[model samples]
Target: ANHGLAGAEFLAGIPGTVGGALAMNAGCHGGETWGIVERVLMLDRNGALRERTAADFEIGYRHVGLRDAADECFAAAWFRLPAGETAASRRRIRDLLEKRIASQPLQWPNAGSVFRNPPDDHAARLIEAAGLKGLQIGGAHVSEKHANFIVNPERRATAADIEALIERVQTRVREAFGIELVREVRIVGDKA
Candidate 1:
């Protein structure tokens, strides 16, 4: 049953490197990758290698805290799980996939969720209430189907386009509802 089960079924759909998964604790639905992590192997800048237990790092929802040591990289991870019915787990995974495809704006090149759910509140509802759905900035637009997502409808959007749209949405939501929406997507690189 252990081999037949689909406990890590969500891992099959995520598009990220194993190192990214370990660093970000990437997950879908309610299953986090870190929940099953048993141990990690890391390499330092000087090429020194070490093994650390899961308890060695601070694991949080969708995030992992690394030590202050510079030039460290994740080498690999070990996972643990119990057995389950293979067919049933596969069916559950399929159902989840179907639901996501139907409800999310996956047809466009938008980063998944723009903002994390605030304490006891959903980001989508707040954005919708601010009248931001379908709002546009350059080639990027807020997905009408899902307010929390910003899609590049024109396919010509730069990172600046997306960043501006996100900030506009955040500002509007804050102004209208008095609640600050915290972004889920990590914005990197210099400003354009």
Candidate 2:
């Protein structure tokens, strides 16, 4: 935005890195990372570098995967952004940041949104409707500010606590609305 790019302003409030954004096809307010990506540099497990385009990957809501199924990670990317006034772009960023602070659980340690929105419905809406907000499991709790967020406000929640809370939210939402909430955050490792 300092460069006066308009399309990337949606990224201004995301908490993770570019690589993570690319990996998850991250977006908010209808602007996905892959939507602006023109080309990307990837490093394979063997340390070989290669360039790929949008066509080289299968892209979907909150998902991206190499069509060739190669093991690789994003190294860099070139984006195609439209030019806009610097001031306007900066204002958009500021507005987005303010919106995030107002709506999200910024004071606690949490993964951004915990679940993908169901088709034609928001996960937060379903979660809140299911009475999951402020629901606690051990030291982690569903954020009162945003039902989609699972926050470790005291920093004392174990990974297991968060995981259990995630499952609890999923189960309750499913039972209430008959919609399965897909996770937006990835969990990897041996179970404790």
The candidate that wins on TM-score is: 2
Candidate 2 Cα outliers beyond 4 Å, as residue runs: none
lDDT of 2 by residue, 52-82 (tens): 9999999999999999999999999999999
lDDT of all predictions, in order shown? 0.82, 0.93
**After best superposition, candidate 2 residue 93: deviation in angstroms?**
0.7
* lDDT for 34 (candidate 1): 87
Model 2 has an lDDT value of 0.93
Winning model by lDDT? 2
Which regions of candidate 1 fall more than 4 Å away from where they truly are? 1-3, 67-71
